[model samples]
Target chain A: MTGRMIQRIAPDALAQLSAGRSTVLVSGTNGKSTTTAMIVAALGGAVATNTTGANMPGGVIEAYSRSRARVAVMEVDELYVPAIGASTLPEIFVALNLSRDQMDRMHEVGSVARRWSGYLDGSEVHVIANATDPNIVAAVGTRSATWVDPGWAWRQDSVVCPRCTEVLMWESARWSCVCGLRQPVADYTVEGDVVHTLHGGSLRLELSLPGAVNLGNAAFAIAVAQRRGVDSDLAARRISAIDDVEGRYGTIQVGGRTARTLLAKNPAGWASLLPMLADDDVLIVSINADEVDGLDTSWLWDVPFEELAGRTVGAHGVHRSDVALRLEVAGALPVVDADIHRLAGRLPQGPCVIAATYGSFETLRGRR
Target chain B: MTNRLTIAHVFPALLGTYGDAGNVSVLRYRAEVRGIRVSIVDVLPGDPVPATADLYVIGGGEDAQEMRATELLRADSGLSMAVHRGAPVLAVCAGMQILGEWFTDGSDSRVAGLGLLDLRTDRRSVRAVGDVIADTTGVLDLPTLIGFENHRGATSLGADARPLARVLHGIGNGAAEPVEGALQGSVIGTYLHGPVLALNPALADYLLTQVVGDLAPMDDVRAEEFRANRFQRARA
Candidate 1:
């Protein structure tokens, strides 16, 4: 709202607000909010950030105007990266991994990469990119970038060469296309929990955030902090302090049962987070087709719900049946309910996990 | 009836967007439950497309991958031969477009298809995207077809091709004809990709019956309930 008022007064308000500040902007299909939060934790003091995950141009402008600090770390939506980059002209542009995310709005994965490549090409901003993802490598195209190996768990979107359109050859962890587009040598390679830095030093990232995905996000945050001259060990320590970003990985008590909430907006996210939910005796998943959640729920089929076969699963949301159907086919019986709170009452009184899409997650978070 | 069913999932790397690969999973699950031995072959770009598979499933993908898949499938000619041999084939979205005579690419360039189906696809003024409910064309014993449609082309059927269903809700085929998909011989193509067959079990059974002649009814109560719920929601 502040962003709109400022923009109403001056059209180039984002540009004007970011004029003399040292800003580091981050954008990607996943991990934008968590990464920005980690970066903020690493660069502790008077640092301004949109920690709430409102990553659009308006939200960015609002963050910049509200902060009285000289350094700002903002997470920009993948679609808004070009617009924000043009306005902020940040010292470093962190290009995280791109995957199939909100296809109804973002359109194609390749299209997003093209836009990123167009913005970063020839621009003077120092680029910190993901080396493992073929799409990111193609987008960073010939630009001198600090490549980080955060790992690419989702390979369905990156099967074809972004440049040649030929099938890319994936031999274990390495990928190469016939057009000579290959995974670049990473300046920072993550092996297990330790990130091997470009300077030949290894730093162990012990994040409070669960899942291997968070470790990957921490590597990018550490890279951004190091670029800003923060000590590697100090950055890792600060990053470990962040337990959750927004409602992600947060917990809520429901009907005397503690339900850990997790957010997975797309297939790649579900693929990474589902395994973490495997140990839970009971699980609740909510999906909504609201504008924010991408109205089409067909992507439900892309998720490997088969992994949760024996667990007692509850489905909630506007598209609860759709999710239940997908689970049924995967050999899991899912109980459907539109109201997540009401549905949680029916489940056994014990600890459970709730994984939800954007709109549903927001609704779930609001109930608290 | 063949004791073993080999299903070829063609170009999964290139064309398995939108969870369309779930179609293959559905086929495997439905087949295995019937006590029939089933094997799934994931045919990638450079791999030889098997012409003798009992069933074949192709999926939706982005324009670039769709274009590349079309080229690779065209050169392989295995899919066309399988269709010739009366093997059941299911194609969805871009896969449906790739089986047609011609379709537009991402840049709206007209590209030649495999010509497996007598249809041509051009641009829709607005891309058809949402939940779709259609009535089956009586070729298969099925209930109301319920799934999701997200496509950019308006497909027109030719003399030899017939529509698999008539659209009751969403904009399907993106054509004035109000049809959803095209069918010819043993091949079925549609824009519906709730992995269409998984949502519509009757359609899966129909396809299974085509290859195995008769199918034993499996427990599909949850699937039917899901379909009913979505159908009611789509109608609402």
Candidate 2:
């Protein structure tokens, strides 16, 4: 509501409000909020950020309007990057991995990549991008970029080379196309828990957040911190202090069982979060068709739900039946319930991991 | 008949943007549930599309991958011969477009298709995206076909192929008459991808019947509940 009012009252509010601060814009299909939080925490000073996950122009204006911090780290939405970049004139523009996300609204992944490529082509905005992702490589095409290997696993949307339009050959961690479009050599690479930097220094990222994706996000954070004149050791220390980004990965008590909330809004997100689940963790997945969650539930099939075959599963949300049906196909019989609050009684006596879409995750987090 | 069926998931890595792969899973599940042995062959870009497969499934992709897939399929000629031998093929969105005579790219330039289906696709001024319901009363003998349509191509069918379903709600083919999909003998093309078959089990049964002849019905109560909820929600 405040976002709409800010846009109406001051159309160029973000530009005026962010005049003095050194700003950093983080935008991607997944891990935007978490990465923004990581960067802010690693930077350590009084940094202005959209901690509530408000990433659009209006939200950004509100964040800037509320804080007097000299350093600002904003989570910019993929669609709003071009406008936000122009307004803030950020020193460091971080482009994380891009893949299929909100297709009904975002259209296609390639279109977004093309827009980023056009915007950042010759601009002097120091781009720190994921070298492992083909779309990120294509987006920052030939530009002088401080590339980091964040390790992308979802290759469905990146099968065709964006440069030469040939089918890309991905052999292990390296990928190349016949027409010369390939993965960029990363300046910073994350091997296991350590981030190997270009300068002969390795920082061990002992993050409190679960999943290998967070480890990659920490590597990006450390690289951004290093560019901002912060030591890698200092940045890693601050980043390790963060346990949860806005209620994600936070545990809440529910009907005598502990439930950990993990937010996975797209296929790529689910791919990263699904592997972090223990084999015997009692699971509850919630889905919604609200505007934020993308009305089409077809992307559920793209997620490999078969991995949870032997686990005790429960489906909850407005679209619980859709989640239930997907689980059924994958040989995991799910107990369906529309309300998540009522689902706690049906869960077993293990650490219940609740994987939810955007709307459902917010609702679940609020109840805690 | 044979007790075994080989299903070809064509260009899975390329044309699998949406959850269109669920169609292949549905086909395999339905066939196996009926005591039929099923083997799936994932035909990537460089691999040969098997002509001897009993059924084939193709999915939606980006414009570049769609065009590339069409060229590879045309060169291989495996899908064409399989369709000629009366093998049931299900193609979604971009997959449907590539089987036609031609379709436009992102820049609105005409690119040649495999000529498997007698139709052509041009770019639409506005992309049709939302919940779409179709009336397939006579075509597939199903009640109120429900699926989500997300595409920018306006397809015009030639004389050889016929409309698969009449759009009751959202834009389907974006044609003069509200049609959802195109169908030629044994080959089906549609923009609906609630993986299409998962939401419409009867349609999956129809495709399975084409290859394995008449089959007995299995219990699909859970699937029916899913359809019921989505159909209600779409109507609401």
Best by DockQ: 2
For candidate 1, what is the DockQ-based docking class? medium
Q: How accurate is candidate 1 locally (lDDT)?
A: 0.86
lDDT of 1 by residue, B30-68 (tens): 888898888999997888999889999999999889989
What TM-scores do the predictions have? 0.95, 0.98
lDDT tens readout by residue for model 2, A114-211: 88988886467999999888888998988788989875457888888987779889887699998888888889998899899867788888888888
Clash pairs for candidate 2: none
Q: RMSD in angstroms, all models? A: 2.1, 1.4
Which number leads on lDDT?
2
lDDT of 2 by residue, B1-236 (tens): 56788999999888888899999888888888899999999998989999899999999988888878988988998999999998999999999999999998878899988888999999999999988899886787676788988999999999998889988888998867789889899899999989899999988988888888898889887788889888887889
lDDT over C-alpha atoms for residue A220 of model 2: 87
Clashes of 1: 0
Model 1 misplacement above 4 A: A278-281, A345-350, B1-4, B138-141
The DockQ values of the predictions, listed in order, are: 0.66, 0.85
| lDDT measured at residue B104 in model 2 versus the true structure, 0 to 100 | 87
